[model samples]
Target: MNHPLLDQFNQWLQQFEQTGSVIDTTRLNEWNHLMDQFQTHPEQLSSNHAQWIKTLAQNSKAMMSVVEALQDQATDSSEQLKKLREELHQFNVQLLLQQASLPQQMAPLLFTHTHLSTLFNEEQLAKFEQLKSSLNTPQFEKLNQLIESFMQWQQAGQTLTEEMNQITELATQTWQEQFDDSLSAKDQIELWGKIYDNTYQVQFQEPSMQLAQSGWLNGWADLKLAWKQLLTQLTEQAGLPSPEQLDRMIEQLDQQRRRIRQLEKRLSALESGDHNG
Candidate 1:
């Protein structure tokens, strides 16, 4: 139906058959030239012309064969290119399937599925199959739908992740406002229990909420580890809080307090004795 290359093929055929072309002129030129050269020595000239004509005819056949070979090679190369493109397209589809997440991974074997592949009609498939067996138009149409659906799924994931992060941040700030004070071990445990109770009471929409919760100490564990590491580094550098020295200082201060109280009472009793005297 489409005649771009076929018309060109026709035009080339016309050129070959035109005036002064080999296909027509070569047919009788050898005999005519030989006769014109040897009108006097007919026998010898006729023998030599016979040999020459045979050689020329063979050469023409060889030339035509070489041209035909080249044409075959060109057709082969075109077919190879079409096959390679179809392979690349199939690879792209497989890559999409590999990259799909939970919701996206729901639809499988898309090329075989009617809802996805129905977009391609018979003509499109025929054209595609003539090019390569791996990718008919139906497969290609399904590939398009899968890619579109996967992209939408990815966008949805991104939106959900952003919302979760916001919720995590809000939860962190609200908890800090409520319980951001230094408490003893008992009080800390009690407050943590209260938070655990509140978090347990709320129902979550995310099906994977339990998985999220496992990672969730709601960000507290990460913050604690970070600050503890920082403090450890600072304390090592300051060379303070040696346990033996703290205990020794506490003992000496307690002894000094008891001795000073005794001295104060003894002085008060001496003053009363002097007054009575």
Candidate 2:
């Protein structure tokens, strides 16, 4: 929209149309003269034209960086979630093996029934069922509830991770297709701007985006809460603090340390005043 050179060219076109046909020698000569002036003295272009192009390139790079960051976040979350799931799976396997070997002695532990079922072949399940009667009824019920809660958390985490990955892919594809270094700076800026606007709407305001937003954001929050619950239960069983509890303790300790430092400074100032007095 702000292409000064294009605007001048358009003005020349209008003059040519008004003054004479393209075949007119006089009009052609005038056009040639204009071109000669532009070619001989590039200063005819705005002084800040190069600066404008640089700014446009910088803006484009910044936008690409945002997409890259989002992609990285999605990738990190997916990997972290995968690792957490693997750890939880391994723990479940160990617990199942222990219970199957000595059901009467083993304490009840929560495991996602569906996921646990998948791990066991029919033979293993049949083998494990021999000790089912030995399970504490009340503890079994608690474990069932815990497993259900964990499943909800797992579902949310999966949904969020999937949606994040999908969006990142779409953004990356759009950026690549629209980006063109060969285009003139002004054309490039305009093209990139249009692409950005359309891409933004498609990526953020479309039905897919709306659904992702609703599901992923809330799912992530719910997963965090569920993780805390699971962590708390695990910590209690292990006679150790949950990560959340440890984090809170660390935060409180930091605050107290800062307060102590402030108080020490105040006490030092009072002593200095007293000595002066």
Candidate 3:
């Protein structure tokens, strides 16, 4: 009673009519009714092309869905790969920083064991060695901090030494403003005391001429006391070590003192009132 073959024949006829050929709804409806009547009988006709085409359409949709799912996975994989690469780059940067610090961490130990060890204390040597042996993750952290502090101190000491040299040169060259209007009375007094520091004896020549000037004689004794105190503080500040450096420094001071004393004596003799100017 089912006449699927006749059904297909009528469907093909309808497609043919719709393709550039005129179609009449009246005739088409009559044909469709006849086809249905045959199809209902169950023994009219049969064909495989229409069912195969229907199955192909369903398979195509499933294949498209699978392709879209694969694309999404690819995009997700790309994002994950980017994140992993950035993490790797950060790890490399951390490794480089850690590597750079290794030498500084080892310097104190190396300095203690090298020929420079003779210049350092036995306690310092032992401490550095102990620090080297105790570099575990859970040990006392004071050793690491000490090493870092030592490095910073060494750099600062070098910088201070250079600045001190420049200061000494400036002080010596500016001595001509000795005690006049060029520098304030206070500044001149301070500068004079700075030079006389570490020198042997402060000999005054022709004290009578100096006494003749009003207020000068009284100020002289007080200035001498002030100078002696300033010299003591200067020596303490200079932090001289080793008796040899002290001896050499004293010799330099003696030479300058001799020159300044002779100059003062000659000037005082020339200014004498009881003799020729």
* Cα lDDT of model 2 by residue, 176-264, tens digit: 57767688857965875565456556667667657655664554355445546655766777999787788899999999999999999
lDDT of each: 0.46, 0.53, 0.45
Off by over 4 Å in 1: 1-137, 183-277
| Whole-structure CA lDDT of model 3 | 0.45
Q: Can you write out model 1's per-residue Cα lDDT over 132-174, one digit (the tens) per residue?
A: 4454465354333434333333334343344344444444344
Best by TM-score: 2
Task: Report the alpha-carbon TM-score of model 3 versus the true structure.
Answer: 0.19
Ordered list by lDDT, greatest first:
2, 1, 3
Minimum summed lDDT over a 10-residue window in model 2 is located at 98-107
lDDT of 3 by residue, 1-277 (tens): 6556566666767776777554356654654555454435423333435554445445544444444444445568555434434433333333322322323323444354311211224566566556656774433343444453444333333333333333333443345435365787468658655753322122123343223222332333343333334344445558845344566799999999999999999988877944762
TM-scores of all models?
0.22, 0.32, 0.19
Q: For each candidate, C-alpha RMSD in Å? A: 37.3, 21.0, 41.5
In candidate 3, stretches whose alpha carbon ends up further than 4 angstroms from where it belongs are 1-140, 176-188, 193-277
